[model samples]
Target: MEFTQPVDSNLFDDAKVVGKPMQRIDGPLKVTGTAPYAYERNDAAPDALYGYPLGAAIGHGRITRMDAEAARSAPGVRAVVTTLEIDPLEKGINNVARLFGGAEVQHYHQAIAVVVADTFEQARAASALIEVDYEEGTPADLDLDAAFERVQGTGEPDTLVGDVEAAFRDAPHVIDQMYHTPAESHTMMEPHASTVDWSDGEEMTVWTSNQMINVNLKSIAATFGIDRERIRVESPYVGGGFGSKLWLRADAVLAALGSRAAGVPVKLALPRPMVMNNTTHRSATVQRIRLAAREDGHLTGIWHEAAAYCLPGGRGENPTAQTPIFYAGETRRVKNHVVDMPLPETADMRAPGEASGLMALEIAMDEMAEALDMDPVQFRIINDTQVDPANPDIPFSDRHFVECLERGAEAFGWSKRNTTPGEQRDGDWLIGHGVAGAYRGALVLPSGARAILDGGKLIIETDMTDIGTGSYTILAQTAAETMGMDVADVEMRLANSAFPASSGSGGQFGAPSSASGVYAACMALRDKIAGNLGIEEASFNGGRVTGGGTDMALSEINEEVSAEDAIQWGDFQKDYAMGTFGAHFVEVGVHAYTGETRVRRMLAVCDAGRIINPVTARSQVIGGMVMGVGAALSEDMALDRGRGFFANHDMANYEVAVHADIPEQEVIFLDTLDGVATPLKAKGVGELGLCGVAAAIANGLYNATGIRVRDYPLTMDKFIDRLPAV
Candidate 1:
């Protein structure tokens, strides 16, 4: 199919800005310490009071009463605002619990009160003086395996399709295995923080670190029965949010309440220890994947059952979402079973659905390939479907999954992988290799942007957040490419509620959806300019009209671009399922004595459609892959079953892959275009790189030691007991 997307051949033929190794546009400011964060925005309020948080000591219980007598008598204490003193808080749009937990404590370290003082250290000292009496209730222990038996049905409490039972009975080769993964924390560089200054009665202005600025504005305003427009939430530069900062948290609420009570602005940021349990996290899961393949090695029945624990209202949205897209099968059923637990609720993280799903599914795929005695790449190629497997009518905008696997295999040197465990030994280590396909569904959300062209420069503004994924640069590139201007001439201002709403920065939707909004405004501007030039807009693309230098002639040909021009939904996304697909190949070596698995080399090939900025795109993929390695080999939020809480709340016990633990990494992008996606024909690459990543590494461990581990982190203790009788 011919591509309708415009090519930057004139300027980017050698891939200058499109594929060049350009530094992040905002990197200098961030490194030089000029980028202001939520709690660091000193100009938002004058002489702001310092507000320190108070967390619940119990995992789950009710606060019967609180004593602020000692705190009030403290040296620098100004005021103490608890949930009892503040206006009743409304449930946030995407939040499951109240920001300040008081009546019934939801989870460990849930917010209870804030002590306002003249100094941060002084406020922190006063916060320790508030005494809270608790009426303890037996906490619903947060173990996926313990409550899995009682919880039945899928994510919606009921799920089914086709005749999976009969198909499984009739199949020749079948594999039924259970996999377990522990809960994980976002652990972003910056903690959840906010600074609020209340002025003009109920009117409040908040500087918070949040992914969705407008959501925070509306949620914060509604919390105290105030007008939605009365509260202004500004979050222009956020440090990082791996889905942890997606919505307003306790910090914002505490700051606002403290400011009002003390009659001064208050700044509040959760301490490092408080960040672990105060915010939501990636939940633990127990998944059972049963695959039945026919004698000819074709899948007949596929059953995926996932059991996870969350608060009553918390749901793992579409946990089994990837099963429908990858392969073709007649009898298939994927279900998500959730149990109500007093543990912290699970919320969205990068690649929320597929990151954990692929950790189990793709490893199962590796087992199936071995059982069928077929090459893993060939097995994937055989089961590849061009159309959506669940619904045949919805065709992929373009599916190059087969090509990704084929090209990746050749580039990854799969022939060198011996395919035999323990036989391929390298001196002090056992070496092996494995591969898994990655899939993340494409998402298109209605978005809006406003652009202004003055003189020769173009400025685009939106409420979309960057989150350290090169959002500003890519948005600039998209607007520049569309308006046919130099990239340097384009300016971007993002993450302000005064701007129009975008899809926001969840699920890797920022690049395609927000940039598409810019495309719409640019198109309208071009059309209006053509009208003033007395020329048909359709023919204006072929030539440039020159002779207007800062005069009415230039203004005559330039059109006004506003938010209204970019708010309409288009047919670009509905006609095709615009997705990004890839595969990860891993080579690992496990220590014979210590039983430590070390990744030797890694490679990934992605079909993400016309990468707008290669530098940022490459950074995203490499960073995601590193995190995947951490998930497979080291990271785990271990629970103290006796205490009914996370034992490793700090980074000391919970381990992640360090720089020494990392391996040689490489990334590849397939060249393709999809005008149906947007004017830029690009999909989000941030989270897509992580899908199916852990499975590839886990499978590589299997190849290395012949040990089939069903639990995540692949801890040394699990294999130390079973170490081949040295």
Candidate 2:
């Protein structure tokens, strides 16, 4: 089913199940601990052996020698496989660093070997017996400041409109500043894990925790030089994957190889430290933003230049992606630069580019407002653009940025904020308020699904993963609404390579695309039911089909019915610039003597089109808000410059937000629909909630202390001495 034209009217208009705040269908299983994760699938692979991986010590080096004889002869050891014994595996299309089976180490903690044994402790104990020698190479660039000067432009040097330099020179007001954000770890609850079972060297099945099952299948097949159909991947439950599980990691690869070598099923779970140093992370960025505006607060020119580290044959973060679309400007330019580095490969983390990019851009917006002597919310409202600023010829499909800001301001009590910094003192604390706008492009990918009707129950099947993002509930709502049945009658089966291919879960595209696919399949099933009953017109209601003065229970007519279809996109993107918009409002209190900052309260208003399940959507948004808080105040992966490795690799040293760190949070979603987006008319809301949150906190800190910290995490040490003496 091609989604080439806008849906004039669909079953979703009078949706009975979709728009409600339905509880997650998988909640019971998760709470009861009945759902089996990758490493806990003991029922399927009861005789599975345990595999322990050994990572390299050097960041960049060639393996000089490897001796695994001791490990092979250790107690309870069944097999030992080292990188030196196997040919280098082909890199997956979506992977940056090679997973395993390589002599040349790309970064520190790169896996070098795996030891399989009868028990996990035995495998772990035996793995330490393997010895390795390495010859280190010249150290790579480790300084972000030095790398920024020599970084080369990625793709187009810059996105240009009218004369940006001239506009900036002639403008009456200008605010120019540079900002820095350090590398961040995903730190999801579940570590990278997988269990692989090979069948007589002909086929293999892997139960793994991954975001995209079909992509994992292709990657595994490519790595082993086997037919794609010879492998199967299944992941019904994932603890969390902020984007860390989107690709094939070393755990899956090592488990597959170990199972093959030992002639038994093997399971591997990456240790916490290995999960940090061996896997991908969000790259650090240095961004320079220059905003030129008039005295009346209208933006004249916007220029954003960003440079970030990138591994060889890898794409760096584009910190200027949102600059050309967020606000209106006559002349604008966006430049992205990449510097080659020998750090662990960097990839997506939640919102990715927008999350880090907006942290700088939105704070710059606040600074510009201060220069104009205007209210920050009013400044953003004045510059709201309904069309793409870089290309005015294309208009946005649906944008309510001004609405978001206005609503958020009203809800957060913007009028009560103290305009003067350090003036609203309560004992030893100073209070202030801040606001930042959010924007992230709405993306869609072709997805397919199969719907089956059997025994008075509707079943939806797809390879889409939940990833702790509520995919199961939303897809069930889609099927129930289309088929005129209760949500309880719908059974959702997902995250299996044997099922139909779906969009998978990344970049906030999972919900809408996969739901649309389910809608298409349901529509096909409706057509088939109508044709089977020999009725020209039919309506499905109360689990019965009625047409031509004849009515019958759906289950009575047929023992089983099934249909499969895919929602294919056309030229909608070329005609419409579709994106999500939101506003973040925050209140902060700063200690006058110690310069300590704490977020007092937070509120987010979003305009991302129709929300399928408000309960799950709110959970996603609030979770993003907490992550943003962490990014603004705590999360940082400190780099060891001398050795080129992340020094704080464990959870103890890497601080994240706990219950005590977060105060009150509220999330509101505007009731909207985008016809150009999809039949579901719902854009992504998860990443949009995070886009401007960090900036709002930073802006709030500035409002309370009258000091601007360009670097991220906004730690007290950065401004402690500058604060007033006790």
Candidate 3:
């Protein structure tokens, strides 16, 4: 079904299940520990061997010699495969670094060898017996400060709209500043793991933890130089991804190789420390923002330049991606620069570009508001634009940015906030309020699904993954709404390569795109049923089909029916600019004596089109809020520049938000729909919640202490000495 234009009448208009707050259907299995993860699939691979991987000790080097004789002779050890012994494997299409079978190490903790044994302990013990000699080389640049000087443009030098320099110079109000953000880890609950069973070198089946199952199937096939149909990938449940599991990792590749060598199925689970260094991470960024506005608080020119490090063939982080669309400016410029570094592969995490970009841009907005002596919320309202700032001809499909701000401010009691820092005090605490706007583009991809109706029960099958974002529940809701049945009556089978491919969870596009696919498949099924009954049209309600002056139970149809369909794009994306908008309001209390900041309350007003399931959408928004809090005040992956690796590579040293750290959080979704997005009229809300959240917290800290911080994590040390006297 090609979505060429706005849907005339969607099934959700009188929805009984789609918009309701429904509990997740998979919750019972997860809480009872009945769900099988990658490494715990003992029932399917009962005779599976355990594989322990050995990673490179040096970041950049060549393996001169490897001695695995002792490991081969170790007790219970079945086989030991090293990079020196195996044939060089081709890099997967979606992979930036080769998983295994290479002499030259590209980054720290690159997998070097794998030892398979009868038990996990045996494999771990045997792995330590292998010895390797490496020839180290001069490390690549690891310092963002020094690398910024040698940074090169990434493809297009800059996004130029008008005369930016002239507009900035002529503006009456101008603010310029530089901001820095450190590298971050995904810190998902489950580690990267996989279980592989190869059959006589002809076919392979892998039970793995990943986001995109089809991508994994193709990549694994490419790496093994086998037919695409020869591999089957299954990821029934994923603990969490946050973009870390979007591509093929070393766990699956090594497990497949180990299984082949040992003549038995093998399972590999990356250790805690290895998950940090061997996988991808969000790269650090250095951003410089210049805002020029008129005296009346209208923005005239906005210039954002960002530089970040990436591997030689990797994509760089673009922190200026949201600058050209956020506000109405006569002139704007955005530039992205990439610096070569010898570090772990950098990739998307959460909102990626917008997360770090807004951390700087929103703070710059707050600073400019102060320069104009105006309310920050009012300043944002004054520069609101309904059309794309870069190309005014393309208007936004549905934008409620002003409504988000006004509603959030009213709900958060913005009128009572004290504007002057250090003036409002309660005993030993200073109080302040802050606000930041959120923006993230809504993206849709080609997605397909199959629906089967058997004896009044509807079953939907797709390769979409949950990844803790409620994909299963929302898709079930879509099926239930379309079939005119309760959500409990619909069974959803997902994340299996055998199922129809879907838009696997990433970039906040999973929900809308996958659900639209389900909608199309259901529509096809409805048409088939109507044609079989010899009616021109049919209406479904209360498990009964009515058409042509006849009503009958849907289950009375003797023959089973099934249909499959896909949602393809036409020209909607090219004609209109579609994005999700939100507003974050935060209240903070600073300890006058210790200079510590504590969040008192938080609220997010989002306009992300029609929400499929409010219960799941709220959970996603709250999770993002917690992550944003960590980004603002705690999370930072310290770099060991001398060694070209992350210093705090384990969870012990890396601090994230605990239950006690988060106060009460409220999420309010605006009643909206975007016809240009899909037939479902729903957009993504996962990444939009975190877009401007960190900046709001930083702005609150500044309002409370009168000290502005341009660096991320907003650690207490950055403002301890600068805090005013009690």
Instruction: Score each candidate by Cα lDDT.
Output: 0.78, 0.90, 0.90
* CA deviation > 4 Å runs, candidate 1: 1-21, 152-161, 538-564, 571-575
> What does candidate 2's lDDT look like per residue over 1-726, in tens digits?
998887777778788888899899899999999989999999889999999999989989899899999999999999999998887899986788988886999899899999999999999999999889999979776888877766534456578989999999999999989999889999998999999998366789999999988888999999889998888899999999999999999999999989999999999999988898898899999998999999899999998988888678787687888988889999998888877788888988888899999999999999999999999999999999888888888999999999999899889899889898656777898887888999888998889999999988999999999988999999999998888888888999999999999999989999989999999999999888888888778898888889988798876765688999999998866788999999999999989988878899999999989999999999999999999999999999999988878989989999988898899999989969988899988887878878899999999988888888889999999988777554
Which of the predicted structures, 1 or 3, would earn the higher lDDT when compared with the native?
Answer: 3
Error of 1 at 325 (Å): 2.1
Model 3 off-target regions past 4 Å? 152-156
Backbone clashes under 3 angstroms, per model? 1, 0, 0
TM-scores for candidates 1 onward, in order: 0.93, 0.98, 0.98
| TM-score of decoy 2 | 0.98
Candidate 3 similarity to native, TM-score: 0.98
State in Å the error of residue 13, model 3. Answer: 0.9
User: What's the CA RMSD of model 2 in angstroms?
Assistant: 1.3
lDDT of 3 by residue, 1-726 (tens): 899887767779889998889999899999999989999999999989999999898888789999999999999999888999877788886688788986888888999999999999999999999999999878666779766755533456478988889999999999989899989999999999999998366789999999999889889988889998888899989999999999999999889989999989999999877889999988999988899999989999998888987788887677888888889999998888877787888888899899999999999999999999999999999999999999999999999999999999999999899799767887899887889999999999989999988988889999999999999999999988998887877999999999999989999999999999999999899889888888788998888789998798888877789999999988867888989999999998889989778888999999999999999999999999999999999999988887778879888998888888899899999959888888889999999988899999999998888989999899888988988886
- Write down the RMSD of all candidates, one decimal each: 3.4, 1.3, 1.3
lDDT score of residue 531 within candidate 3? 88
Candidate 2: which stretches are off by over 4 Å? 152-156
